[model samples]
Target chain A: MTTVMVVDDHPMWREAVERDLAARGFEVVATAGDAGSAVRRALAVRPDVVVMDLQLGTGSGVDATRDVVAALPGTRVLVLSASAEQADVLEAVKAGASGYLVKSAGADELADAVTRTAAGDAVFSAGLAGLLLGEYRRLQAGPDPGAPQLTERETEVLKLVSRGLSAKAIAERLVLSHRTVENHVQNTLRKLQLHNRVELTRYAIEHGLTDPDSA
Target chain B: MAGELRQRDLLAPLWRVVVAFRLVAWVLAVAGWFRERDDYPGTAAPVAVLVAMAVWTAVVTVAYSRAAGRRTRVTLLDLGVTVLVLAATVATQPAGAFGEGAPIVTSIWVAGPALAMALARGRDGGVAGAVVVWAAVTFLRGYVGDREVFNLTLLVLTAGLLGYAATITRRAELALREAAAAQAAAQERERLGRAVHDGVLQVLAAVRRRGVDPELTRLAAEQEVALRGLLTTGPEVAVGTADLGTALRLLATPDVDVAGPAEPVELPAHTAAELTAAVREALANTAEHAAGAHAWVSLEPADDEVVVVVRDDGPGIPDGRLPAAAGEGHHGVRSSICGRLADLGGSAVLHTAPGQGTEWELTIPRGTPR
Candidate 1:
């Protein structure tokens, strides 16, 4: 069974999600109500997937996601948040979340997302795809020469995804294999994450928060 | 309540400054009377006027401190006292002493009323008060000499400039109050939005996900989408323009998914409305003809054009179905979608097969008609 951890500030929501995931055959290994305990609990249990809520009442879920992903290399984070927080969702993704699912998703959809996340597939919503497309376009328009660029095929696949096409449908339309389509989607996210990491390191070095020799 | 009091007293500091100025000017007048006491024919009238000037200055000082006390009647009374003091200079001075350039009994203290008038009204009132004083000075001197001309010019300039400054300060205060009110309103809205998101929206989403009753689920889903749209909308756009992304997001329902960039996609307000209307028509058609079909609307903003794609995963239109519908006087697709895009100097292309889904690609060029 895929081990899962749920983090939400609302006790009702946390319990409901825990029950639903347990009913769906996933092991409910750990749960937390805020960012601090979330990281601590995730480190203790080392679950296969962490379902994160963006608003934690005390601290940021993005920080928890970064800490959890950094500590456990085998674990993946899937943000289960409200759809309205686009900027926070994007930040969580850059902080190393593998996928996003709105809280309104049914139990079946939630299970499918968790399963795919555990299998290392990029579970994207159309909104996330749109945000990534916009981010890439923004970077292209920026002054940095070393900014990441998407291949033409990746852009095409991302556009289809933004239009609410499933991976299987995108694979059939682009004449690519299903795993290849998933890889393209995953690669886009990986590049964004890599760029974010580089930017953060550069910022740290410039601000003298990190020693250049050690960095 | 504190902000209301502060706003009401925006000019309180200005009035205090004016009072300080009057006290300083009154001291100068007293000094002038003392210095020229030997030059006057009789000291009693000048001494009486000096005492009256002292009493009036204290009265106006106390009166102007409060907002309710700074009235037009007080300002007019102030001007009347200033004129009487200036006229008294004639009785105190020796015969032909004005021709020798002896200073007036009130000296610089005459400027007090002019400044008060300026603060109460504006440039016009300041000029009017200065002119009244200038006329009294001219009558006392019996001629417009170089000294009288110089005094008139100085008084008018001081009153006019101070009046202009007062007007600017009032305008800036009003603008600041407006901006602060707007920011406070926005912050309150954000707080309410957070509360709604934390409590109400969560319950609604849970209800929708439970799917206990189809109608209840549908209502909950619609409210969730509507509330999310309201909370996530960008700041108000400039007049004559609208964020197309926000308009598109409002169309999102359980069966129809709308996606757009995080940044605002602004277009001319008319263009955005027409494009939204066209998309609504397309979604309505999908609901009527393609039962149980899920629709997707995506907004793509490019360099020189905006593209909207509405696709449905229902059974596609067969060959010649569009033309056949047009022939049968059903102009839904012809007039509503395609014709609307055509009028916008854009094009709508439909792609479909018998078993495949239907897709409508609508493109509108930027900076067209408007």
Candidate 2:
């Protein structure tokens, strides 16, 4: 059974998320009102996924997301916030949140986002996905002219990522094992010091790893 | 007020008329004396007085035209010169030659000092100076006749009327100065109103529109009222300096952490208010945008400046986000945060990027010279 932890400053919001996850057949391991306690509870429970609010009273949700990801890389964070700001979405993404959903999202959508995050898929609200994609393209245009050269296989993975292909899909297309593809992705991430696929895709586009015809 | 006499536009024509009259008196006195040359046996004394009067009138005409020449000392000396010339005419004239129809050396030239004193010191100075000259004439004549008494009263009345006119001119000048001051103050209030409109009022309106929490809406309404009062009240006219620490303390709340020196950070009231307003706008941005954020504010006073830092632990503003926000009509960071500091001759530096939190350093110099 999938396990989830809810973190929100508002009692009602935390309770609602907890109830929704429970009704969806997911076990809610714990709930917290702030970043510190959320991190502590997340570590103790080792929930498969954490549904976190961006604002957590006196603590920061972004910081909590970072802590949880660092402490338990196996655990995923799905941020739910009242703001649909581009900066907020990007920050949460850079902090290692697997998904971001606004509070205005329906219960079903929240449940679906949580399931996708647990299944290791990056989830985003409707328009936010495109916004992040556009931001990635814009950021890619301006960077080191002398970018680190990528291996032939890393470039192939980069092209697939830029075309918005999933890692598993890229592995199947390339006739490689999923673990080998992930290792290539990790190697590129280390060379670039980028935190996520979003940045990597942007870097690929800037360095002309992706073809316009393929995209 | 030192150059009040010369500054009187109303008196400029009067001064010209007085000068013209003195010139006419000199011409007339000379003509009258020459026509009645045989009437006075001694020519030396009257001729000497006549020459002195001509020289003095010529000197005064040029001197009074300049501001430095219009000093109180010069006015009094002019009066003394006229009085002595009048008295000398009496001593030089043969007995009974200064009777009715006879010409005095000063003639009507005494009007110069009478009108000048009125312009300088208003009614009282005019009346006093006229009386002094009138007494010298009466003393030399050696008898208080009907004509002498009539002339003395005439001098006093003319001086009084001229003095009254001077008082009116002075009052008009004062009123003009006060009107100019009021206009400047109104302009300042208008500028302050615009700043408030861009900053606090916009935040409050946004909060009110969100309508998520009733308590937040109520707080916004309360602030709206307070902000309106602040805009209309103009800058406070309190005597003592404003304490920056005390003003900063007012911003500290349960969610915000404020740290500053125990000693009062004494600053001019307007500067303190500007600095505080900038800080308030920064806090408002954090509350409205940064989710689950905690804020910290610190103040450090350097040798000649005060450094205030406001930081938040939240999803930091992304690179290029501010410019993008500006394009999308976000004025909080532009007008409220930076504009206010710029007006006070201070600077606001924003430090932020994606993933990292945001911090702002506001540095304002001491003793703003508004």
Candidate 3:
């Protein structure tokens, strides 16, 4: 069973989410209410996935996400927050969160997002995908003459990656070997110093590598 | 406070003009003396009397130019000196010198202190300053001539006219101060209205929507009580900048977590308060409508604007719920949340759907928009 830890300030909301995930066959390992303890507990538990909220008492979920991601390479964070603001989504994505889900998401959607996030898929709420894409377009419009260039194949894989396509999916669509797709993804992550596909997607999108026609 | 300073500023130039007029009068007296030198009875030294008038003019000008407030003794001394010089000229000159209508010593210089006194003490000071000068003229000639009486009338009129101007200036300053205070109060009231409309009213509306669900009603009641307390206490008289991060923290509880930048996201106090209030409204909605909702608040400071996001982990608003709510006269989403931002030259965007949680993106630019 996949192990998950929840970090949110509210006890009732935390318990509800824990119950929902537990019923769905995921093992709930631990929970934290504040940012400081969320980091400490997350490090100790090393859960496969962390269901995190952006707001904590005097602490930040984004900071905690960064700390958790830094400490555990295998761990993925799925931000379960109330805010759908583009800046919040961007910050969490930058901090290495694998997915962003608003609190209003159904238990099923949230559970699905958590499982997908653990499996290394980037998930976003309904309209937030468009908002993030718009932000990426704006960022890509800026001048960055010194930015490192990617090869044609790597750029193709990145464009697919930014469209929220999984490595296996990108491999299938491009008729490339799964191993070859994974290699391109790893190389892209290294070049951008990004930890996960989510960050890679953000970078690709920011560099205008994503194709609107393909999406 | 500024109004008082401004009133003094306006009066200061008038004082300068009065001093200049006094100086002009001294020059005219000196010229009249030189042109009529041979007409002197020879009883008084013309040069000595001319020298005294010139020295007094110099002293009066210097005293008036100093930026001192309420120089009562100096003003009194000025009036005293004028009377004494006029009496001395009459005592020294032969009776024949008075046959020509010109009063020899310090002639028109008598009205100088009257203008100063009128500015300093209003009409009363004007009348008193003119009284001493008129008395000297009356004492100099045993019987006052028609021309001398007319000069006395002119002295009193100058005093009265200046005194009235002083009164108007003071009244205008008071009106300006009152208007400023009223504006501040009105601005604060509107901010308080926005806060109430955003937070408390939304909670109450949520309770109304839930309609007799005991648990939801109980939660709504608690919020209603809190809102009532806030309304009764009223908003603080906000001034200067407020830390957006710090103000946001107050909206957090066990269920609600507020995260912000380490650095202060400072905004104008009213804007910060309004923004925080809008965030609180978002939280209140989550608590009231979103079942078992966990909400988060995050602040991001950009180059030109501060972005505040209030998110909740509850079943989100239905697709048409906001418009429906507005149609039903539920203004929490409209006026308190969006209208407040509009007033500040900012924008509020809401993202939510059934089974998805509601989030508010509040963006306020630095400084007030024109």
Give the fraction of reference interface contacts each candidate recovers.
0.41, 0.00, 0.00
Please identify model 2 stretches exceeding 4 Å from their true place. A1-215, B1-8, B94-103, B200-370
Top candidate, metric DockQ: 1
Q: What is candidate 3's TM-score for chain A?
A: 0.69
DockQ-best of 1 and 2 = 1
- RMSD after CA superposition, every candidate: 9.1, 22.9, 16.3
**Candidate 2 chain B: 10-residue stretch with minimal lDDT:** B230-239
TM-score, B chain alone, candidates in order: 0.54, 0.52, 0.49
B1-370 per-residue lDDT for model 2 (tens digits): 5565446555566666656767887888888778877767688887898899889989989977766675667778889888878877876776776654455656667666876776677789889888888888777666788988888788888887877887887788766765676678878877887676556655664554454797886676456545643453222232346766557646654345454533456778788898999999998998888966767666656457988888787798988989899999998899998999999899999988876578888998876433
Clashes of 1: 0
Which of 1 and 2 is ahead in lDDT? 1
Better of 1 and 3 by DockQ: 1
Q: Which ten residues in a row have the lowest lDDT in candidate 3 chain B?
A: B228-237
Q: Candidate 1, DockQ to 2 decimals? A: 0.40
Best by lDDT: 1
Give the alpha carbon lDDT tens digit for every residue of A115-165 in model 3.
887887666432233333333333444475433445678756654453334
